[model samples]
Target: MSKLFTPYVIRGLEIKNRIWVSPMCQYSSQEGMPTDWHFVHLGSRAVGGAGLVMVEASAVSPEGRISPDDSGIWTDAQATAFQRITGFIRAQGAVAAIQLAHAGRKASTAVPWKGGATLSTREGGWIPWAPSAIPFTDGDPLPHEMSLDDTRTVIRQFEEAAQRSLAAGFQVIEIHMAHGYLLHEFLSPLSNRRQDEYGGSFENRIRLPLQVARAVRELWPEELPLFVRISASDWKAGGWDVEQSVLLARELSAIGVDLIDCSSGGLVADAKITAGPAYQVPFADKIRREAGIATAAVGIITEPHQAEEILQSQKADAIFMAREFLRDPYWPMHAASALHAEIGWPKQYERARR
Candidate 1:
């Protein structure tokens, strides 16, 4: 039997296979609500036979949104919109997951399609917040350093979003702690130059992310899986790296995080990231062995054999394919065919099987 075809169960949730569709921003929401775009985008992955289909980086608050058009779970009305999509994913026999995010210094930007630049109120953006008053872009407006009360509010927002995610029918919740977003800002010393409880030392730097994970564990069900995606390395000195990642993974697993989705870079513009197939896989491998936890490997993983090798080597617990899935939504079905593995296709499309 193909190892990739084998089911992997986490926290009592059984995924039919090891394939996971990584979260990619859709930038298709209006006022923090999901629309048909979301339904079709994520539902197609379910229909394509992926074991798990994770929704895009969903904001936990209005200001946390990367773009004004980003999906959100900050309110019940927003959660209501997601119910339809999660319902469809479940009906199609795939597990539904979401990446709850807060885009700290990177917030208040236009969609990538619209140039992805900082926005002003006159041009339809709001003030952004971060660990420190830093600007993601050279010409972007400097964000306000989050006050103690503001930090407290963000924690509450994440707790509330976790509740909303459960009510919206999500089976897995992944915290978006990667990129140069709010939590990532906290993790990387290059971005966070504070001297308070949330910065300076490694413990202080990782405080917020761990607290968020603990809070989510408190709010999220014990039987359901929880994931924390982190940029394993910021690709720069004096910033977050694999060593720190391993340490954090140990703590997170102790606090009930089922897996660490290992990704890399994106903490700043100056860092040089060497991107290629399975480049980030080593990070996952290190954490899985050193931290003694399951992990998901992502970034430029395309071919079926490439993904298979990742599993056969015991490098990661799962493969998160991004651009490959975009290129072929039915990759899981096609991969099963290519590898001579068994995974059921959608009933409606099974008749067209080659």
Candidate 2:
């Protein structure tokens, strides 16, 4: 039997397969509410046979958005808007998941298609917040240094968002601690240069992320699993790396985190990275072995045999594909064919399955 097509369980949740749709931002929302575009974009993947179809990185608060158009779960109206999308995913036999995120120093930018530059207050951008007053790049506006109260507020925001996610019919929630976002900004010394307890030491730097995790886990039902996405390496010396990631994973696991969605290098713009197929699988393998927890491998992973090999060799517990899924929403169905696994196709598409 192909491990990639095998049923995987965590807590009380049994995902249909090891193939999962990773969160990919559409940068398409109005006032933090999802539209018909989101419904079709996410629902197509569920119908296409992914085990778990995750919504994009949804900001927990307005100020946490990477772009003005980013999705949010800060209000009841927004959560209600997500019900139809989640319901469709579940009905299609795919687990519905969402990533709760706070962009921090990276907040308030034009959408990627529109050049992705920083927007000023006149242009509808707010002052971004971070561990320190540093800007992501030299020419960018300096982010407001988050005060102690601001840190507490962020933890509360995550807790509240988890509540909203459950209300919205989501079965899984992945904390967005990866990329160059808020939590990651605190993890990397290159971005977080504060002298407070949230910075200056490994234990101190991880304080807030852990606090958010603990807060969410405490409020989130024990029957459900919690996942965290982390940048295993910043790809620069003196930045967050696999070692710190292993340690962080252990801490998160102790606090009831069920899996680590391992990815790498987004803390800074110029960090030297050598990317290729399965370049990030090593990070997952190392963290899984060292941290003694489940992990999801992501980044440039394409093809059926390659994904199966990663699982068969125990490199990662599951596969999280982003861009590849965009290319073929029915990737899992095609992969099952390649592996000679007799998985069922949706009834409506049965004629094409042969």
Best by TM-score: 2
What is the lDDT for 122 in model 2?
94
Q: Estimate each model's TM-score.
A: 0.98, 0.99
Q: List the residue pairs that clash in candidate 2.
A: none
lDDT of 2 by residue, 1-354 (tens): 899999999999999999999999999999999999999989998888899999999999999999999999999999999999999999998899999999999999999999999999899999999999999989998999999999999999999999999999999999999999999999889988989899999999999999999999998899898999999999999899999999999999999999999999888999999999989999999999999999999999999999999999999999999999999988888899999998878898889867
Model 2, runs deviating above 4 Å? none
lDDT top scorer: 2
Error of 2 at 267 (Å): 0.8
Q: What value of lDDT does candidate 2 attain over all alpha carbons?
A: 0.95
Local distance difference test, each candidate: 0.92, 0.95
Q: RMSD for all candidates, in order, please.
A: 0.9, 0.6
